[model samples]
Target: MTPFLTAYLQRIGWTQTPDVSLETLRGLHLHHNGAIPFENIDVILPHEIDLSDEGIFQKLVVARRGGYCFEQNGLFERVLKEVGFTVRSLLGRVIIADPPDMPPRTHRILLIQLAGEPWIADVGFGGQSLTAPIRLQEGIEQATPHGLYRLQRNGDDWILQFRHHERWQSMYQFEMGQQYQADFVMGNFHTAHWPTSHFRHHLLMSRHLPDGVKQTLTNFHFTQWQHGQVQESQTFADVAALYEALQTRFGLGVSDARHGFSLQQLEAVMAGFAQHDEKA
Candidate 1:
């Protein structure tokens, strides 16, 4: 194995030999979701979202950092292919906010084929993401560590929904269109550079915690959910506290060397969070 792949395996604490079976796929997916965080600090800081292999390796494995959907799932696609699994890149939209129209295809997911059976695997959706692979069947509830998820057909597309508050809410909608490298490049560009994009302005971070809890850091607010219900919540008093929580609680190993956020930028982001909190 190459050093980058070795470091990636070590980063996820995967000790077993890799195989192209469903068991390995589930194990790697779950381990990755729990190990690496879903963070959009680069977008918030207006940094480069490099999707290349070397870029991903330096940012994720070498630097011990995390990334948003494009970077996270992009690297995962490479790893899955290296392990002999047939993986295809798929795109989806974010509908959790109840937008008036169909949102753009900003979310990246994987469709892996094993023994002629297809499955959905995503570790990049920060809040309430899937922790295990799900079959590509409609109206079938697939159980994960977080909650129950199901996929329903909508014309030529499929809507992914999660059981929330005793109701299945639409998370995203997408067709099984084959995604290319340029497709993700365009999506990443829009998400990372567009002024209207929430990711470009907000700090979003999340990870699966032990005992089947979901922990998320939205701006400076920290929340823990169990079975889709908020179990614990708190807000950091200042940027320092927020940084500490990101390091200790989220395991993001954020630092000046890794993030390269200037003091002015940090203060500005903190101020932005404070303003949002005031409005809330």
Candidate 2:
């Protein structure tokens, strides 16, 4: 057992040995959402990424930092295993807000078996997801703090949905399957290095709140949402202000000259967005 897991468990207030039952799994999911964060600074920095248990343990547990889906779900899987839950890695795609029919398989998530039923447990997705595990059955609405989410069947894949203004919207579709670390390494590299990948062009960070809300920082904008309503939203004027917000609001200790996206570059990027939007 690594000290990372020990420390994480302690931080989550789970001093007792973890149980693999549904109740325990729910508790773990809630704890994860409330404590850990979802971030992509490592991706932006083009940091050496690894999917091994030890690698995830070091990044999330030892460093007391957060990561994107791959890193977050990777570590969460290991923690579940340590706690006696049956977990497996599953590949997923990002369904952008536009193009209602297109889904790109560039993301990773987790499928866990707890209490004899398959549950989708993802601590990696920053926003619009369940903080607790949900059953994989089709058309079954699982009530979560984020919203009432459901798994809808689509051919061989399962589509995750959230109730939005009394209707369901497809979030992402995933298959219950096994994947190895090597499978993710290629995609991770592409996303981190490829010019077209959004992660390469944007600065993103998110942290789950104690009241089931989520705080997100994207480019120069900071937004906090609770139960799907925007609680707070603001924009920074410069990179220095952005960095200050990251450290003060997100609890991140990032140096202005760190390995990831720099303050100047981020400001320029945000300026470009504003320009583009104004043009439109």
Q: What is the Cα-based lDDT of residue 58 in candidate 1?
A: 80
Point out where model 2 deviates above 4 Å.
11-16, 98-104, 255-280
Candidate lDDT scores, in order, read 0.85, 0.73
Q: What TM-score does candidate 2 get on C-alpha atoms?
A: 0.86
Candidate 2, residue 166: how far the Cα is off, in Å: 2.8
Clashing pairs in 2: none
Candidate 1 wrong stretches, greater than 4 Å: 256-265
lDDT of 2 by residue, 1-280 (tens): 5576688797666766677788778777777776666777676555677767777766666555667777777777878888788888898767636555664566787888766778888887776646888888988889875668888887998888888888888777777666777878766777677777777656778877657778887767789988778899988776688777876787663542333356675565566655644455
Using alpha carbons, what is the TM-score of model 1? 0.95
lDDT at 44 for candidate 1? 71
**Candidate 1, backbone clash total:** 0
lDDT of 2 at 136: 83
